[model samples]
Target chain A: MDLRDPALYAPAGHGDAAVLLALRDPATGALAFPRTPYGIGASGTPAEAAEPVELSGRATLLVCVTVHQPLSPGMQVPLVVARLRLEEGLVIDGVLEGTEEPPPGSAMQAVLVMQGERRACRFRLVGGAA
Target chain B: MSGLASMRPVRVVGIGMHPYQFPSETPYVHLGLTALRGALADAGLAWPDITFAAIGTGAIGMAAGRVMLRHLGSTGLEVVQVENASASGSSAFRTACLMVASGQHEIALALGVDKFGSAQRAANKDGVPRLTPEAEIPAVKFAMMARAWRDRFGLTREDLARVAVKNHGNAARNPYAQFRKPRTLEQVLAANPVAGDLTSLQCTPRGDGAAAAIVASEEAIRRHGLDRRRAVRVLSSVSSSEHQVADEGWSLVEMVQRSGLAALEAAGLGMAEIDIIELHDAFTIEEIVYAEALGLCPLGEGAAQLRAGQWDIGGGRCAVNPSGGLLGMGHPIGPTGIGQVTEIVRQLRGEAEGRHHPGARTALAHMIGLGSVAVGHVLQRD
Candidate 1:
């Protein structure tokens, strides 16, 4: 899916569908997480004009830093941020999921999760199971 | 030889700065004039002696260079303004250096002025549109890089915290530094966290300030009968934009590597010959990353070098950020690059009282702007 297309963004009150689409691979019947998106071709843009690609295989995640921002009013902690290179060619940034405090460069799987009121892509430690 | 080396020698005859502080009702004129006058006085020259001027600022638009410089009596000399993100002031200094080195002008002034707190936030509608779903802010990008550095090099939180400790300590001695309080490793660790492992003390606080430098050709110095003993020669200056990196948020690493090497080559010196350094430590993690990129150590070995006390003042090794750095020195965007140059000039001139690096003969100043760009300058006392 072209990221710039309005369709890539979930319709109002359709957060669930957005989460599902973010995690499901259209090229295959199985589940997969969308990797970093970017534009290609003559009009290559960043996230919006980029091609749609999912993690073709397991990817390693490196959690960079976590800081609390005003999601509502007060501050929140453990807002884990990370970078992952997909089996394809895209390297993207996302939130890291889970509370176990995975070591840096830990193997992780991208998953759809809720960040405040919005659906966001995050990574979860694979526990050598991916 | 680099273009700068092939041209006539340019020397920094004077440097000045307004103490960095939180934005207040004060105008940019006061900030700019204060630094400019200080620079003129430091150089023992008058405003009429300036043949050209270059002003660097990130925000505060509308002919900013002319507006502030007019207060100093515009001799109708060329006044150019530059904005290169965090490297704004460094870029300005480079421009002034080139003008002098190329013999385009005999005497030039590079001034940087900024006041963000009193300014209005302009929408980012003009630049490249955000293409990623995630907001790739500096904190986010650096946080991720910190993680990658850790995974690749075994750098830990404690190792990073030491940078804040050292820089804050240096800032405590700098009257011009916005943050004058020294921090301990425990204090740094105890502060509120920002990005991955970065804390409030580890991140730079954007404040309001200005810095200025007067550069002159050898002919100008001779004609004006200026004190040659104190003039710091600009051996090399190099500016570069982000290159394709191994991954996103790693532009700083790549850009610094490219520009730093070019700068050293231009200066005709090795990294070991540099006595002191001032770099864009916008975050503590950057100090580690840049140290490695600047060839002070191998990739992933900065943490070890930090622990070995190699970068400390009077530690018999090159001092990093003796002027406190962006972290503790106060990063007022435009003034940051000039501020780094100010510190280097002072150190090389033996004017950095209380925080002097003993026997310092050569210094390097580095700054980076995210999205991203890097600027490097090598200066020598001889």
Candidate 2:
């Protein structure tokens, strides 16, 4: 319940990092991001000590209809923010990678995206848009 | 006398609003005072006549209600603060109505005043878990919904743009509107896109404003010899929160549908009886989506009905957002909901001049917030 406590999320070691990275749901077989509610107390245990399940990298991407990205103090541009639907039916918001903006409902595959100090799941188009 | 006859009838005897504008250096006290004074003046009553007040604010924390009271001489009237995201104002109005209906107070005041400056972060304090980055910001979440709507209903970009055009046109006639200039579909389409097909004009601007309404019991109306002809009766008021469903699309629309149904049932009326509506059209697409959800049109037919001018002023059975919705009128969060009540009251009284829907006898004022809560009110000419 103490969400702010740093000890609640601290990983044990490199082996634990893999465990955290491969976190998945046992009930529905969906991949879960570490620190999320399901990933933390999944087994009725503390997040740092919870057992992690392996998950495949595949996912279905729901293409974004529109995007808003503020580049600087006064400038903003259209960006791609897609919804990734994992095989377990868990969907998440993630950034889409490509040179061109894909049409809405285009298929996408899950990938890792780096955001300075953080890394989260992102998606890339499965095939080029028609 | 309809389904509302059973309960002690509460009437909106007065309504007032502070012109919405961009966040300024002006203090909250001044803004609150302006609206409170305006409402008191409109009601033709003094502050002492108000037995209770419910103040609605989303972001102004720490004694938000008392701060406004302190400016008005602190008459020892009971004051309660309400926070329900964008629905804060309507929720506050409902509280005041309940006070009068319960016989706890003869005269009650509901005031919504809010300011969102550059430093403010748009956070929902109601503790709805932010599952993803898109869900954190309102635009992205609504954008996704808009995209899904487009995909499901085959709504074109122009169909969405028309909503902005119509609302802006309605706003132009409203002197109290924040954005009075009418917009064209081409101009709306050319505007900077926010999420999906939503352009800047399609989204409500976060501004600062205050709106106030006075609800009086029938006894108080008779005691003050108030003009009953102009008083708008509160037929029904209902509020509902969103269910934690996995599908975001149904979260908002479904909430509105359920709450609106309850309101209509309480009023002993159906959607067909509604002549005017002031809804929380936070986005252009929301107007279409909510129209369907509220039974203005059959499901998935909001866009087509809109194109047919069913929602336009004087064009169909019901005129939607004749005061220009949040899309065109400017949404100052807490004040927005109370402002809807003001518009509905005015419409029911036939005071909405240029934008008045002919023979407007019944009206609905609705608002929904980020907590995924929806509030609906049915109002009728008294």
Candidate 3:
């Protein structure tokens, strides 16, 4: 299956899980996710000094909300959106796999799921982890 | 950087507004010109008397200033358009203050005007792709914030509704507000849910309006014979953007705190001295969180303050959003921030007849834009 945004994540080489692509500034030890050519903004490190890295897709759910209205074009209603803290300490927002809001501090893992025609990254609660 | 206090003093001599309302067929020119004319009349200054004009707009395209100002008879004054997202008006007002304080201009105009739907976001042009585009919607982002606050601070949904209740009640008395009807907690809760716990009534309505503020130097006020008794002095102006912090969710709040403190420090005042506050309340949750962030109360105590009516117009401690705030007054993009200043000036001058905060002497106007940037200003009467 084709990925919706190949630049943001890729298959983890194990069953349906995915790994988030990120960048690490060599000098400052700072990490940025969804790797961009702009490099780490905080450290002002040039792209040349940044190394490619992959987040394990494991994160702690910080907060989540259910969007009841399709506020944006092509958006479906009652979808769950969440802010997650990656294992590597980077915070990012992503779509949750279920409409139900998982409590903050719940352990979650990223997985690719069909969004219309393309596969997109969605976070799901890790079994027996909190 | 030297604050406004260290420089030559600047005062707001006049303020006017074209009442904010739902999106209509009214031309942006009409909305803008009405405000400009009202301000010129209020300040007792002609078009040529003004040395500079800062046009704050979000939707209207380039050269908005020249096109709009020429209709009032071009005076060949310096004109620059400022666009800083939601804080466009605040930035324009700041520019006008700076110009007068730096001796660049004797008198300047900060005008904010906008229409709905035409504004565009630069985030779409950036190459960054998002995992959840829906989260980019402000309502969704703030709803998540409301959820986080609720979990961390035990904030309830009713607490959020109360913000709407008070602001809508305030708006009912503000002739310039977009939402004029007062809503009860039940009405707000029963309103259409937009995202998370945010109902339609809890969010700022999409609208079109114009607001204008004329700033002048002390020399200009004397030379023009403007009423000094009504002029409110610009005490301080501070602007800053978000910095990376441990909690990404509260990054905006962090910026507000830094800028708010810097503004107070620049003015040589404390929180106890602030009599009124006009803040960005595009969402109900913003007022509560930002008030706490600005030290109106300790963290997790904003709800209690609201319940106690301490933030009301006559609640005793301080009047917040006396002109109805964004939730009720209307956030017409560029005009929202300048409108806040206009409301502050009126309150300080004892001119906000119907919605006046009694004995209001000092006021602060705080606004945040799309870049997650924050701008704050402190103003005082006499």
Top-scoring candidate (DockQ): 3
Q: Per-chain TM-score of chain B, candidate 2?
A: 0.94
User: What count of clashes does model 1 give?
Assistant: 9
Query: TM-scores, in order shown?
Result: 0.86, 0.87, 0.98
**DockQ ranking, high to low:** 3, 1, 2
Candidate 2 deviant stretches above 4 angstroms: A1-57, A71-77, A99-107, A114-119, A127-130, B1-6, B118-135, B246-249
Q: Report lDDT per candidate.
A: 0.79, 0.77, 0.92
Tens digits of lDDT, candidate 2, B65-114: 88778777878999999988889999999999989987899999999988
The alpha-carbon deviation from the true structure for residue B207 of candidate 1, after best TM-score superposition, in angstroms, is: 0.6
Separate DockQ for every predicted complex:
0.29, 0.27, 0.79
The 10 consecutive residues of candidate 1 chain A with the worst lDDT sum are A15-24
lDDT of 3: 0.92
Best by lDDT: 3
Model 3 ranges with Cα > 4 A deviation? B247-249
Error of 2 at B356 (Å): 0.8
- Candidate 2 reaches a DockQ of 0.27
**Candidate 2 chain B: worst-modelled 10 consecutive residues by lDDT:** B124-133
Report how far off residue B199 is in candidate 3 (Å). 0.6
Q: Rate residue B53 of model 3 by lDDT.
A: 97
